[model samples]
Each structure stands twice: as structure tokens, then as C-alpha cells.
Target chain A: MNLKNIFKKDNIMPVAVLGIICLVVAVLVAGINLITRDVIKAEEDRKISESLSIVMEGGEFEKAELPSDAPSTVTAVYREKNGKGNVVTLTKQGYKAPISITVGIDAEGKITGAVITSQAESHGKTGIDSYVSGFIGSDAAGVESHFSANHVTGATVTSEKIKEAIYDAFVVLGLAAAKDTPDVPEFTPAGEASLTESEAIAIAKELMDGSYTKVALPENMPETTHALYKRQEGGYAIHLATQRIKWSPTENEAIVTVDGLGNITGIKMIQWNVGYDKELLSAAPVCTEEYLNSFIGKNASSLNRVEIVTNATLTNNFFGEALKGALDVLYPVPIYSIIAIVIIALAIAAPVAVVIINKVRRKKNEAK
Target chain B: MKQNNKLSIFLRGLIAENPVLVLVLGTCPTLAQTGSVIAALSMGIAATIVLACSNVVISALRKVIPDTVRIPCYIVVIAGFVTAVQLLMHAYLPDLYAMMGVYLALIVVNCIILGRAEMFARKNNMLDSLLDGLGMGVGFLLALLAMATIREVLGAGTFAGIAIPFLVGEGYSYTIPILTQAPGGFLVFGILIAIVNKIGPKKGEKKRKEFSCEGCPSAHLCGKVSCAENTELVITSEPEVQGTPEGKEGEA
Candidate 1:
């Protein structure tokens, strides 16, 4: 091939066009990158500051250089301005994804507080609320055993992973016992108490007045199931019951308070087992105090008529049924009796109407 | 070529040639980012900015681009816009950038941007191409929002992370978790496409005779037998056709 022909009009046109376009695009991208570099860095710095404040109880943070031999889990260390503690950010392998926790360890090596900055653990909320809370007043040496003894039963993996992060913080502060020591023990709590029967009774007592007294099932109310507590005071009875929502595997236990006039005074969720599925659990609205308070002032018969929470429809519906069941035992509306009477009336009216129609038809036929 | 009206040029991409639902382009990002309403919305805006910017630049340089190297030229321009958008999002909306993950960078290869460049921007004026890109971008955003709404509402029971009061509560357990997963993404995408197909313009209305070489942008440079034969026939017949004036006059 001739070198001159290679650079001729036919070939060079395409090559030059592509080269110019590439050059222009590269210049444009480079210009944008230069402008955004500092801003991006600042944003990351702000996130670190926020996480530090949350875990360290709101104090100014100055970045501290990590020792060269620091463990890989210790991503960054920040010293508190008041000299109270050091906030250590650590990343540990969770059950599904990496769990990042910012832990504040005081100068004396006691954990001040710990907050999960970012985590991919499936049941993180329950773990954070229950197991991670156990670390607040514990020393660095006691973290492993405390976690092993009080791990959130259903969220064992997540609890253990959080413990690993806390242990990594211990290593950073030079408070750990030994490098090769196991972080989490194999002990698991047998039959963890999510909610106990006595706890449900206590919640009912709080919702009702102090004068309420627990009573055995009355002769007229034998059909009520899951009724943990039945209290009667001033001609009113408050019943606390647990009812499973239809189509849901979990059950919601609630206390329903009723007045003498068959009106629901209050309702409260004592305990609930929303499923272990992460997406479903996060999406399922917790039966909060404000939500249960909305059921007050409505008659038991009108429980289904209340406004349903948008995403918590099934939970709200379950609360309604539980309240309705409790009210049925007290008021005995006799919905079945009303239905039977209506059917009997319809059965008698149908034959009489048919006879009158036949007599009119005979008269018309005779005239014709 | 007859110039399209400004409104029709902008509106056509919204329904007639929708990049996501109608044309079935850019399914990777559509499925991945649509697990949440916020993620889907962020991806849509980011992609739209890139698409519109790339279309305008490509159309402006259309005259300078040689046909043989058009695809590479278009890709470079598209990738530049994508990188710029990614950097800007990272700097300003860092949370959204983190949430979108790989899909934001993946916009460079998203077929909608390049497809518009090749099929419309390369042949059209800068203004028309800009409008086409905007319309297609908006169409893509709408399709994503529709899917995200269904998935987030049914699967996660939240609209943009704000819980819907009716769908959630202690005793309410009717959420279908599968809608937020990958299979749900495909199901919602297919349903949206079907709905668009039923309501939008009828298919096959403009019938063009498609030859095999139609898909090759540089058909003149192709060394295939069919291309060579066609070119040779045209070259050999031209002089004879010009010399035979009596043959043309017989019809007159």
C-alpha cells in the first residue's frame, strides 16, 4: 500500500472527523471533571462529619491520621474536639452486604454510643434497636460476650456483624484483648421474648384506668380466642387480644378498651411479629402509638368504617377485627340474628306476592 | 426532505417512538434503578440531560462527520455528555449519584442516546434533534416513574420512601414483595409497553420497502457481492442510458 494513498482524501476524511470529535468530547469531559472534583470531596467530608456527630453525641470532629498498621476495617478515625472520645468508622462483612458503623469509644475505652452509618444487613432496624443498644454502656472487653448473650434472636447474623465492627473499633483504640481472639461467641438465646403475656396485660392496664380488675371469662362470652386479659371496671370491660391478619403469617396483639356504652375508648398494639423479609418488614408500617390512638371514640361496630392507613391497610384491618371481636363479646350486637330475621321476612313475602300476581293474571285472561 | 413541525418533532418521542416502552431500548438501567421511586427519578433526569446535550452536539457536527466513522463519532459525543452528567450529579446530588450506582455511568451505552443520534440527529437540524432528544428523555422518565410507582407501592409500600398510611399498619399484610425484585421489573415493563401499544399510534402505518443494505450506514464502502453488483450496474448503465436519446423519445 502506498503511504500517500493512505493519507489521501477518501481515507483521511473519516479519520480526521473521528479524531476531532474525540478530541472535543475529551476536552468537554475534562473541563466538567475539574469543576466538580472539589465539590465531590466536600460532600464526602460532610457525610463523615454528620455520621461522626450521630455516633459521638454531637461534637466538633477533627480528622485523625490512621496508623500505617491499622486493620482494614478501620476506614477513618476522628478525634472529638472536647477530648471526650474518638469516633471510629468501620466496615465489616454483613450477612448480605458490608455493614458500616460509626462507634464512639471514650478515652477510658467504654463505648459511648454506636450508630449504623450504612449497612446492607437484611433486618438492620431490629438489630440496631435491640442488639446494638446493648453496647451503649458496655466496656470494650465486654462487647463480644454482651453481643453473644443478647443478640437479636431472628437477626443473629446482623447482630454478630455489628459486634465485629465494634470489636474492630476496640482494636483501633488498643483496647482489645488479643488479635486472634474470636469476636462473637456461639451462644444463642433460647426462645427470645419478643412480647410476653404479662407484658400485654401491663399494657392493657395502662390504657385502662387504675380501677380495672382482671376477671375470668363471663358465661355469655365463651367464644373469644386469644384473649390474654379481661378487666371490668365501672360496668365497662377492657379486653386485650392477639389476632392474626388474614393472609399474613404474622400476628398483631392489641389491647382494646371499651366504655359502658359499647364505645371503644382506646386501642394499643402490645406486640407484633412483622415478617423477617427485609423489604416487606421495611415497607410494613409499625403500629405506632399515634396510629392506635386514632381508633379511640369509634363504636366497635364502626371499627371497619375508620380511615385506613395507606400502606398499613392490612395491619389497620387486623386492628379493626381484634377490636370488633372484643366489642362483640361485650355488646353482642347479634348480627347473625338480624340476618336470619331478614331472610325469614323475605321468604314469607315472596309467596304472597306471587299469589297476588297469579290472581291478577287470571282476571286479565278472563276479560280477554 | 420535508421539515417536521416543531411540536410534532418534540411530541413524537413521547409516544410514537418512546425509547423505553415503545422502542424497547435501554432495559438494563430501567430494570435496575426502578426498585425505588427516588432512584428511578434520579436516573431519568440524569439520562435525559445526557441525551438532550449529546443530541444537540451531534446534530451540530453532523456536516463534519464522515459516514464511514459515524458510529464511533456519535459514541464519543454521547460518552462525553454521560461523563459530564455523572460528575455533576456526583458533586451536587451525591446521594442520588450513590444510589444510582453503575447505572449512571452505564448511560453512555444506553441505546436511546445513540439510536437517536444515528436515526434522527445525523440527518436533521440541531433544533429538531434537540427537541427529539428532550421528547424521548421525557418519555423514558414517564415510563420509569410508572414502573417505579407500582413496584414501590406494592413491593415496598412506600411512594418515594413516604409511607402510604392505608397500605401500612399493625394488621395490614397485603404487600407483594416480588414487585420490587427483577422479575417484577420485567412484568411491569411488559405491561406498560402493552398499554402504550394499545393507546398510541397504530404500528406499520408508514410502510417503507426495506433492503438488506438499509441497516448499513456506509453501504457505499461495503465490499459485499450485493453492494458491488448494485454499484457496478449503476456505473455501467449510466453512459448507455445517456447515449440512447431515441429510446427516451419513443415514449414521448
Candidate 2:
């Protein structure tokens, strides 16, 4: 090829233009990166410092080198300069997603305090602050053991995950002995009912008075072992079923009583293997009477206001689903449900309307 | 070349060539970020900064940039400005940076930036290009604000996260949750386009050809045979052909 052809307008011009633009852009980007890099680092450092202070109160924090082979969950460790405590940032898998916590553990092998740095769980409903505060006075030696004894009702998964993370931190510090717990079992389809259908019907009849006729549960109701029933007095009864623990194979059922106005009047734990086991049953009140009473006045829309029982998060969530199922049957005209219908209708109709309009326009054009 | 008046350069983007409503450019980010007023504002500002900077740079280098490689050159310049903006936002307004997410980086590919660069910036003076970019940016911002206001107020029952009294709450009754989702974005965008089309200036005969490649912002860069250019070529060549008796006889 001729040297003149190599520098010709078509061949070299495109390459030169692109090369020059790329060079200019690269230089500009590099200059910006240099200017902002320190500021970005400082912003991150400020955030960490803020979290450290919140977790370990009344202390100045200096970044401490994390020990090699630190648990994967442990992101950073900070030593309290003026105090005998260290703030460890740990990320553990919560119910919905990873929950990041900054935990302060004093030299005495006791939790000073803990603050949730980041969490995917809904803020208000998780009660994570209260759960973390519970660990303030607890010994770190067996923090995982205390989870079962003091598990927060509505925030069970988040609470347990936080406990496990703190436990790992303690084990890292040589304050606690590490013990492995089996991973919780995934939810399975409902199996054979522990309570006979006749027995459930009899219980439902007694709760509301009058002959109860068995009815099919509404679509998309929570897991149920027994068919729902309606009383002659215009109230409904349904079996709200859930597992005793996340890992448990056996199913537990609660008889939810809903009045004509869609309010949950009562809840009774009718069938649970844990209820039958005297030793395990004595550990904690799984669903206290007061806790069940808290749901009494709440309807489907106001179910969010129902306070979760301590140590009964999974059970209450299951109960909440059951209450929702009852309300779905009672007050089927939810605001979201109506919106859903409208959207679906529009989705189906808009395309059809367009096609019809086009046909009409085409016919008019043909006539003209 | 006739120097375009600065006011026309600015005013044209607001009405005649409104980036989102009229031109129908950069619809993706416009719809996605319009779910909230703050998000839309942040997106609009970020996009505007990038647009203005890219336009000025492209206009300044217009003579130097070879015609064949202009698009890639424009892209690289736009991408640089976008990355710079991203870094600054990340450093100073970390929250808004996090909220804008991928959409901020996506400004590199936004057609409005490249479209303006190819059509207006490459031909116009630097000052005019800068004004054009600012005008288009403000037009996009106004469009986003309009869509976001309706969507946020109706869907979320909030304005910039502040709860709108009477429109929200249990006793007051009525909030459409769907308005915050993707479909609501389209609905609001379509309505705004229709309203803007009705109230804004009617398209002149010249602008009626906008749908064709002749009026396309990227038509010159696309390297396609534009009808307007072809017609002009024929008209200009026709007189020369008529001067020759043989060519006139062939045309007749």
C-alpha cells in the first residue's frame, strides 16, 4: 500500500478523530477522578465513623486492623479509643435480605450495645432496635442460645440473624464457644391435618354458637389444614396454620374467629406438637392471651397496628396472613384489589381499543 | 452562515423541539426517574450539566472532528462529561447519586445529548450550542417535573415525600398506587405529550416533515440520502440541465 493512501481522508481520518476524542475524554475523566477520589473516601469514612459512634456510645473510634480469617460477615472492626469496647460491623442474611449491624462488645464479654447499620426488612415492623437493645446486658458466651428464649415476635428472622452475627463476633474474640445450628427448613405444602375435620368443626361451632357449615376457603388464603366454616349467626371461622419453628416438620393451627364486620374477634392455638410437649411448652408462651387479644379489634386494613408477641415472630406473621385471608373473604373490596382490577382491565382493553379504532379509521379512509 | 439568535436557540427547545414531548428523545430516563419529584429533579440537573458541557466541547471541536467519526467522537465526549458528573454527584450528593443509580451513567447513551451534538452543536457556534443544550435540558426538566408531580401526588399521595393532605390518609379516601409504577409513568407521559401538543405552537409546513429523516437530528450523521437534500440537489442541478438544449429536450 502507498504511504499516501495510508494517510488518506477515508482510512486515517476516522481513526485519528476517534483516537483524539478518546484521549481527551480519558484525560478529563482522570482529572475528575483525582479531584473526587479523596472526597469519596472521606464520605465513606464519615459514614463508618457515624455508625461506630452510634453502636459504641461515648467513645472515639480508631480503625483497627481486622484479624485474618475474620468471618465473611464481619466487614470492619473499630476500637473505642477511650473505652474498653470494640465496634464490629457484621452483615448477616435476614428474612428478606442481608442485615448489616454495628455491634459494640466490651472487654467484659458482654454486649455494650448494637445498632442496625442497614437492613432490608421493613423499618417499623422489624422492631430491630428493641431486639438489638435486648443484647445490651446479655453475656456474649451463648448469645445464640438467648435467641430462642428472647426472640422478638414480629422480627423473628431479623432478630435471630442479628444474634448469630453477634455470636460469630464473640467467637472471633475468643469470648464464646461456636456451636452449629441446622439451617431452617423451607416451607412445604400442608400435609395431613393433626386435627380431624369433625373436631375442628366442633371447636368452631363452640366459639361462635349455632350450627356451623363447612365452606371453601377463599382464593389465595394462607396455608390451611382444615376447611373454613360459616356460622348461622353470620360470622366465619378458619384454621390459620403454620410450623412451630422454621425447621420443624409438624404444622400448628390457630382457630381465627372473625365477626360480620371483618374484625378478628379471637385466635386460639388448637393444634401444635410444641403445645403437647410440656418441657418445650414451658420455655415461653408461644402466643400469649394478651398477644391474641391485641388482634381482636383489627380488621384487614388495620392489621399492621397489631403488635407482634415477643418470641413469636413466625407465628404472628402466619397469624397475620390468616387474618388477611379472613379479611379477603369478608371485605373483598380492598383498595389495591380494585386498582389491580382496573390496571388489568386497561392492560387487556387498551390494545383491543387501538386495533378497533385503527380498523374504523381504515374503513373511513377506504370510503373517502 | 446566518448566526442563530440566542433567544430562538433557547426558546426553540422549550416548545418547538422539546426534547421529551416534541422530539421524543430520552424517554427511558424521563419515565423511570419521574416517579418522584426529587428523583426527577436530580436526574434533570445531572443530565443538564452533562448536556451543556458536552454541547460546548463538541461545538468548540466541530471543525476538527472528521465527518465520518463524529458520532463516536460525540459519544466519547458525552461519556466523559457523564462520568465526571457521576463522580461529583457520588462525592457531594451521595444520597441522590445512589438514588439515580444506573440512570446517571446511562446519560451517556441518552439520544438528546447525541442528537443535539449531531444536529445543532456541530453546525452552530459554541455559545449557541451551549444555549441550545441549556434550553433542551430545561425543557426535559419541566417535562419530568410535570409527569412526576402527577404520578407522585396520585400514586404515593406525597409531593417530594411530604404527604399531601386530604388526597392521602384513611378518612380522606383515595390514592392510586399504580400511578407510581411503570404503567402510570407512560399514562402521565402520554397525557403530558397530548396536552403540550394541543397548547403549544402548531407545527409549520417546514416542521411537518419532522417525522421524515430530513428533519431527524441525526440524519446528516446517519449518511442516508435525505429527501430534502436530494430535492435541493435536483433543483440546483435542474437549471444547468435546462441551459443545455439537449438536456431540456430529454427532460421535456
Candidate 3:
């Protein structure tokens, strides 16, 4: 084909248009990129430097190549040029996704500082800042113990992962000792009395006006009931603890003396773990003698009939459940407790059943 | 008359032919970026700049570019503008650039920009295309802001990262987290589209009916009667075949 013919409108015009457009676009993009390239580089470097400064202040650094055996979570490591410490940047699997963290460790293998650089964890209301800060001053020797002790409840997985990564940093630095298979403590069965059998007799003497002897608890003893002691006169003293109160994880312990007929003759609260502020101190029911005395004459079968203390309904309910459970071992008529359990189960199951039924109905309709 | 025409051309993209709500184009970023107001606004501004710049360039090159290679040429132009915006955002607004992530670079494929290039820009002058792009861009920004406001305030109990006191008070937390998820995005997008449809010009309106039929493939069959009754309308710009007999009214 002739050169002029190649330039004809039909043949070359379309190609020319596309080529010219592409050329112009490439030039425009190149120009903008050229202008931004330096700023973008500086910004990225500044961010890393800023993070390093925050992690370990007064430490001059040089990028150190990660070891061949380094964990995949460790992204980059920066060692102090003057032998001050090391700053490690890591991305570890968190509660939701990979959380980026920066850690600084001194020459002594103690964590100088730690910061969560980025995370997608939803438990921002209960932040991991304090939990992460607890890692400071922790060496590999104490890391495992610290990890077990302080955990952010709602953000447990993420917080645990943070500690794990920090510990991994120590391992990367060769500061961690050889891993030992931790000795697992022997498992004690639940409902085993925290109070000794003799201690129960002593507490039982305070509740009832008679000599009492420690007795083996019934086979159906509830998890909350710690020990049982039978009074010589014809009643039993039940020592129990309940940790089922809302907004608190601590236990509430008590001693209840029940007569032979399963009626409570007296009650004493040994421990009240729930805390109330001064403003609500007047309404605090657990401290009042009247509240404990109110349950004195009530039969364990009708424990729910006692007026629940205002603002302490959860405490009252769990305490009642424990007393009822203890009496059931003696009287063995747990009809009201069974009914309550059933009501709770039904409340949870009703919505789930409705959802499943609706799903099935939709499938059937689709099939039709 | 000329001024009114120009104003109408610009104003129509804002609501009457809104690229997101009314026309329903570029939905991916609209849903993905609108979870937070900052991300949404960043995406909106970036997309608008690219749209306006591409529309203007495409309109200027409309005649120079041959019809056979126009789509590829338009894409090149659009991609160029998108890259330029991406570079600027990455350089100056690094945080926003990080937040938007890949969505910032996805502007080249956003249908609103390409759609306007094919439909309005190629046919109109440079100024008019620029206006259309700006108007449509603003419309997209407004729609995203509306959706993000609802999602952030109700779903996250925050407005642009500042806590809404009543929704997230010290002892009280009243947030519906599901509203920030994918399903919520679709729900809000659908409701907003419905509201626009309700308030905007209807398909059966005399103006829309008359204007839509011009590009309708079966216009000759209907003899330009109302398009409201036709369920199988094929929208095209192809010329009517010569010597075809006009069908009777309602035959289509």
C-alpha cells in the first residue's frame, strides 16, 4: 500500500485517533505522576519515621533484613544504629483481619513501647490501647504471664493477638528463651467446695444455733453450692457462690440454714462483689440486714416470692437460684426452677423458630 | 433562549438525569465508599474531577476521533484523567488516598463518566459537556453524602468520625451496626433511588415521552405515539430504514 493511501480516512484515521488519544493520556498521567512522585515518597518515609519515633524515641535506626526463619507476621525490622534497640513493624491476624502493629524493644529484650498502627477490630468502645501499653517493660520472661493476666474482654482475640505478636518480636530478636511445654495444672472438678469441709461447719455454726457436722454433698449438687453441713438439731447449712450477676464477673457467696422442711431459718451474706457508686449507695440492697432477713422464713420452693431488692434484681435472682438448687438436693421438688428454665429456653427459641419457619416457607413458595 | 438552554443542560444532570439516583450508573463506588462520610466525599471529589476533565477532553476531540475507534479513545482519555486525579490525591491527601484504596483508581470504569462521553459529550460542545460532567459529579457527591450521612449516623453512631452525642452517649449506645454493612448499602441506595423516581420526572410525562421516542428503535412502528405503553422498548440511535411503511398507531 502507498504511504498516502495508508493515511486515508478509512484506514489510518481510526488508528490515528486511538493512538493520539493514548499518547496524550500517557503524557498527562506521566506529568502528574512526575509532580507527585517526590511528595508521595517523602510522605511514605515520614509516616514510617513518625511511627518509629513514637515506638522508640531517641533511637537512630537502620533497616535490618529479617532473618530467614522470621515469622510471616513480621513485615519489617529496624535496628538502632547505635545499639539502642529495635523497632519492628508487624501485621498479625487480629479479631477481624490483619492488624498492623509497631513495637520497640530495648537491648535488654524488654518492650520499650508498642502501638497499634492499624486495625479493623469493632471493639473500639473497649479500646486495646491500655492492653497494648501493658506490654511495655515486659520481657519474654514475663510476657506469657502478662498475656494471661490482662485481657480486654470484648476484644479478647485482637488483644491476645497483639500480645502474641509482641512475644514473637522477642523471639525474633533471639531474646526469648527456649520454648518449654508449659505444665498444665491438674483439673479439679467443678462444684468442689472452695471452702474446706471444716470451714463450712464453722460458718454453719454462725448461721444456726446447733452443732453441725460436715457431710458429703448429694450427687446432684449444683455448681454454685460449695459445701453442705447438716445441723444436729434438724437443719442444714448451705455454702454457695454465684457469679451470674450482670455487668460483674465476681462471685457472691452466702450461707443459708434450711430447716428439715426445706424452709430457710436464717441467711447470711458472706461476700457481696458488686460495687455501687456513692450516689446509689443508699439504694444498695446487699449491704442491708433487712434484705438478708427477708429470705429467712421463705421456703426454698417459694424463694421467688420474696420481694427482690430494688436495683439488685440479678443478685437476688442468682442467689435465689443457688438456694433453690441447694434445697432441691434435700426436698428435691424443683418444679418452679424447671418452669423458669423452660421459659428462658422458650424466649430464646421462639425467634429462631420463626426465622427458620419463614425460610422454609419462602423455599416452598419458590419451589411452587 | 441560549442561556436557558445552557442552564437546562447543566441543571438536568443534578437531579432530572442524576447519574446515580435517576440513571443508576457507577454503583460500585457509590455503595463501597459511602460507609463513611470522609471516604465518600474523597471518592466523590476525585470522581468528579476525572469526569469533568474527561468529558471536556472527549467533547473537544469528538470530531477529530473517528467513530470506529471512539470508545477506545474515550477510555484512554478517561483513564488518563483518572490517573492524574489518583496521583494528586495520593500525594497530598495520603490518608484519604489510603482510605479509598482501590476504589480511587476504579474511577476509569465508572459508567457515569463513560456513559456521558458516549451519550452527551460526543454530541455537545466542550463547555456544555464540562457543565454536564460538573452537574452530574455534584449530583453523585450529593447522593453519596446523603447515603453516608445516614449510614454513619445511624449505623456507626458517628458523623464524619465525630460521635453523635445522643446516639452514642456515655452510658447509652443506640446504633444499628447492620446499617453499615453491604446489605444496608443496597437498602439505602434502593430507597434513595425510589425517592428520586418519585420526585423526579416520570417516564410517562409529556416531555420525557416525546424526547425518549427520538432514539427509540420502534419509533417508526408507533408513529411517535406515547412510549409509556411499550414494555419492550429498545433504546438506540440507529437511523430508521429507508422506504419502510409506517405502522398504524398502537401496533408496536
Candidate 4:
């Protein structure tokens, strides 16, 4: 029989039923897939955006395309204010995502105001929370390269990732931001503890006369030096000489800007990784700002008779360990400790998931 | 059997009739799908879909085909409807498509669809053949559901994957260690068939109903043989002839 014969008035009912079923199933499958597509895209965007924000400039952030020939990991540009309250824009990376930390730089290149124009990171937090904040009063503005800061600790991996992002952003913007080929901090000196009272005084004297240049560099470093100078109070000072960035012994941390003659002109302590957020210091639930401030006026001298925080005892111990290493050159114990902890935690999670899966399988089988 | 004999035609196909349990014809697909109630359900429905359509088409086109080539012609018609059922399952109920897997495509070989088409559809009255195909299709589906219920419970520890609330939490598990395997599928299939066989039609009673009907030849004289057994319902053996005794002597 011909194909059209199948569609006769006598054969209509069954064919109509089949056609309806097919139409419903086709529409349902297509509709469900279409809805999930946008949901999946949004989820992806949220996750990636969170990571990128960590390295963005402070305040408001914007996403912009990097130039075609940009170098490194730079992907976007950002603008923001600096410490002096003026608009100082620079792109850099720390332990987190790539971000442009814009601060106001004056004629002398001192930071006036600071802001983060853009980043890919969690809101209000990045690897720089404890790293770049160390540069409040410092201006490495005109300086092409060279910088260092104490490890932001607990956020080490994130900090390193941030540094890479900053470099990428710098390349995209085609501008010079702080350049350090891997500015890993020597928080705890290799072998010895930091300087003692008498030792601190002696190192201070050496630094004042610029005798710290005698210390051997970490092999391939570029022109590293240290110095001490007399403050107005007649007490000695400690200074670091890796470009314009400075680390002082008298204050928790101090920045000294010298023009050509190497005479100290502008000096300020932005914030101490171990000290308060500012001159007044922010109080913490575990460690009081007052307790942390006690160490601000004192150096490696009289390092005895201190107590850990009441609630945050371990944090206190860690804080002391960080300080002991930074000023005294204590042993580098934190790195080994962190690596061991991470491995153990991951090992625990893996076995737990496997055991759950295996148990579910075994129980199901046993039932039958 | 006379080509015109409707009762012998419908009964021989329907009772001798049964597609699955008696002839054991569609056993491959029967055993495969009887593991779950839903698979059995959809398979039964899909088969019924093909059977009913094929029978109707064959019945409609019965006179158009040459007798020498009729079996082949009927098989082609049956296969076409089976293809339609397969495509319908794949596009609409994809989950059921996965559940039935290869078995759904194997509806072409279900024998019940083709057997009825050849035995009933090719020889009988269009209306009678269509009814027989429907009755048999319904019977096969009912049998599949019955077998599926038992297999899904004892073997898979599931009553169609909806946890049997009273047996809840105890046997409810993501993995079915034994039933998930092949040997288990076979063992469960056999045990379920045994249960359905036990609780199902008594073999002796089945042999009795098996031959009782011969409604069409002399429906009035063949009183008890007429399917509407309770009444002295004088149905014509030949529906075209009214009050059959008037026409009886001419042939006699």
C-alpha cells in the first residue's frame, strides 16, 4: 500500500496519540537543557570572579581588557587612591589575585592616598591584607624594582598567586609597578635568632654607618644593603636598603625616603605586620593591641618575660615566633610546619570520602 | 482452520492465546524487562502499542495482499509499528529508554506482536482481530507487571525503586550488590516467574477455558462456546447472518 494510505480516516486515532507523545518528550528535554545552561554560566562566573577580585585594587573594581602584547599574568587595569589621599595608581600582585593598588603619589613619590581599582579576589581580603599593607608610608613609586615584606603567613599560597596577578596586570597596563623577582621574606633568619638588646644596639650602630652592606646577599640578589641612623630622640635606628622600601628597628616598622645624598628626609612606619593597624592599633579578640604595642617601642633587647594572649595562645606564640625571626633572624620553622599540616589535612579528607563510598556499596550488595 | 472461522482464529491465537507464559515465545525480552515494575510497565505498553497498530493495519490491508506472500507482508507491517514504538520511546521517555536499553529495540522480535499479526490479523474479521490483539497485548502487559513486582522486591530489594515503606531504611541502599549483577537478574527472573505461575492462572482451569469458545460458526447453537457464557445470548457465528437457523440448511 502507498504511504498516504496509512493516513486514512480509519487509521487516524493511534497515529494521533503517537504524535502527541513524541511532541511532549521533545519539548521537555530541550526546555530543561536550555534552563541549566544559563545557571551553569553564572556559577562559573561567580567562582572565577571571586579568585580574580583578590588581586584587584581596593574600593571599587572594574574589568578591562589587557593590551594585546601585555607581559606576564597581567589581564586587566585598575585605578585607585593612595595613602597621601591622592590618586596613586599601580598594578601589582601579592599572595593573592592580580590587582591594581592605586595610591596618591606626591612630587617626591610619597604615597598620599590608596585604593584598589580592580581585582579578582574575595571581597575586602587578599594575600596582601598582611603583605602590601606594610607599605603605607613607603613609596617604591619611581623605583622600577626591588621590594620585600614579612610573609602574610596563613595566606602564603594566596599571597604568591596575588603577586603573579599583579605582575600580569602591570604588563597589561604597560607600566612599572614594584618589581621583585621573587621577594620571599627572610622572616626567621636562617640559623640565628634575631638580635638581642645589646646586639640590637650594635646592629643599630652598624646600620647607622651603613656597615650592614657586609652581610652576604642570598646569592643572586641585586644591591641589597641595611643602615641605621640617629633619630631626633637620640636613639639609634635600623633601616633596610632594597630600593626605597625600609624596615626599622626602633619603631615597629619605619620607612625612610632619601634623596640622592642618602640623608633621611621622609620617615614613617606604615603598619607593622606584628604591630597595630595604625598608631592606636586595632584590638583583637585574642591579642590586645596594647599587648602587641608593648613590643613596638622595644626591640630584640629584653626579649624575656612576655606572655601569650589569653584566648589566642597559639596565635600569640606564632606571633612571637614571627617577630623573633624578623628582627633576630630565628630559624625558618613556619614553612615546614605549614606544608606538613596541609598534607595531613588533605590525607584525612581523602580517606573519609573513600570510606563513605565503599561502605555504601558494600551495604547495598549485602542486602540482596 | 477455515480462513472465515473467527472463533477458532481468535482463541487459537489468544489462549493457545497467550504470547508469553504458554508459548514462551517472547522470553528474551520478557526475562530482561521483568526485573523492574516500571520497565515491565513501559515495555508492556510499548508492545501493546505496536500490537494494536500492527493488527489494525494488517486487518485493514488483509484482502489486498496475496496469500503466498502474506506472512512476509504481515511481518513488515508489524516491524513498521515496532519501529514507531522504538522512536517514540527514544525521543519522549528517555529515562525509560535507558531503563529498557536494548530490550526496547528488541520489541520487533517480541513474537506476540508478529504472532498475533500473522495468526489473527491476516485471517480474521477486522473488528475481531483488533479486539484479539488488544486482549492479548493487555494480557502480556499484565503478566510482565506481575513478574516485575516479584523480581523488583526479593531480588533487587526494591519495590520499583520506591522503598517499600515497611521495609524502609533496612534494604534501601544506593547499590544493589547482588541484583545489579547478571546471574542475579536471571535467578530473580526465574523466581518471579515461578511466583507468578503459582499465584497466577491454575494450569487445569486454563486448559478448560482454553477451548470453550467457538462463537462465530453457530453462535446460537454453540451456546456455551459463545464468550458471553452467562446468557443464552444468541450471537451469530457469522455476524452478517441474522438468526443463523434460517441460513443453516443451505450450507448443511
TM-scores for chain A, candidates in order?
A: 0.37, 0.45, 0.38, 0.23
What lDDT is obtained when candidate 2 is compared to the true structure?
A: 0.74
TM-score of 3: 0.51
Q: What are the TM values for chain B, all candidates?
A: 0.78, 0.79, 0.81, 0.66
Model 1 regions lying over 4 Å from their true place: A59-65, A72-75, A79-85, A90-170, A175-368, B1-4, B170-174, B201-252
Steric overlap count per candidate: 21, 1, 0, 66
lDDT of 1: 0.71
Q: What is the Å distance of residue A247 in model 1 from its true position? A: 52
**RMSD to true structure for each model, in Å:** 27.4, 20.0, 20.4, 29.5
Candidate 1 per-residue lDDT, tens place, B113-173, comes to 8999999998999999999989999989988898999999998789999888888767785
True contacts kept of each: 0.63, 0.57, 0.63, 0.00
Candidate 2 segments whose C-alpha is farther than 4 A from its true place? A1-4, A53-65, A71-73, A79-368, B1-4, B168-174, B201-252
What's the TM for model 1?
0.51
DockQ of each: 0.24, 0.22, 0.25, 0.01
Q: For residues A299-368, write the lDDT of model 4, one tens digit per residue.
A: 3333333554443332343334333333333212333445678999989999987866765666566656
C-alpha RMSD (angstroms) for model 4: 29.5
lDDT of 4 by residue, B102-215 (tens): 566677777787788787788876777777777788778876777677667755567777866544466454434455334665666567556545665566556654544433
Candidate 4's iRMSD = 18.8
Please report, as a residue range, the 10-residue window in candidate 1 chain A with the lowest summed lDDT: A184-193
TM-scores, all candidates, are 0.51, 0.49, 0.51, 0.32
lDDT tens digits by residue: candidate 3, B1-252: 998988888888888988889888989999988889998899889988988998999999888988888899888888888888878886898777667766777888999999999999999999999999998899899989999999999999999999998899888999998788778989999998888877787744656646765555666665432343353233232243322324422243
Q: Model 3 chain A: which ten-residue window has the lowest total lDDT?
A: A180-189
